[model samples]
Target: MAYAMLEKFEKYWGDYSTLLAIVIVLDPRYMMVLVRLAFSKLSIPVEVEASIKEIYDTLVKMYKF
Candidate 1:
């Protein structure tokens, strides 16, 4: 299931990245919350929270500077 989601994400990564970039520009904290909700909906394990946090942190850094 996770692999399936990852495949789909890869297929649409460009679009998703663009959207995330825009959203991060508007508000990175909110973007992180949205990412968390998205992963939760996908049934990502709580154990992967750190990985998600890293992604959110990177996104924040990209938008902040």
Candidate 2:
């Protein structure tokens, strides 16, 4: 049971749901810090910088549209 829960957690941590991330970033209290913290918690190291940059770019694109 513990293993199953851990596996589920790892999967969730490793993947970023774009819309959810965007919403989180929009909040001043959290912003990118929360995203960075989430990725940091994952067992596997993810390229967080690029992902964050992409998110920023996406946000700008969305605003400009």
- Give the TM-scores of the predictions, in the order they appear: 0.38, 0.69
Task: Give the per-residue lDDT digits (tens) of candidate 2, residues 1-65.
Answer: 99999888878666777788899999999998998787666524557767777788899999999
**Top candidate, metric TM-score:** 2
Summing lDDT over every window of 10 consecutive residues in candidate 1, give the lowest-scoring window: 13-22
lDDT tens readout by residue for model 1, 1-65:
99999898767642335355346546846655666666565544773485476676776777799
Report every candidate's CA lDDT. 0.60, 0.79
TM-score, model 1 to reference = 0.38
Candidate 1: count of backbone clashes, pairs at least 3 residues apart or interchain: 0
Q: After superposition on all CA atoms, what RMSD does each candidate show versus the true structure?
A: 6.0, 2.4
Off by over 4 Å in 1: 1-25, 63-65
Which 10-residue window of candidate 2 scores lowest in summed lDDT? 39-48
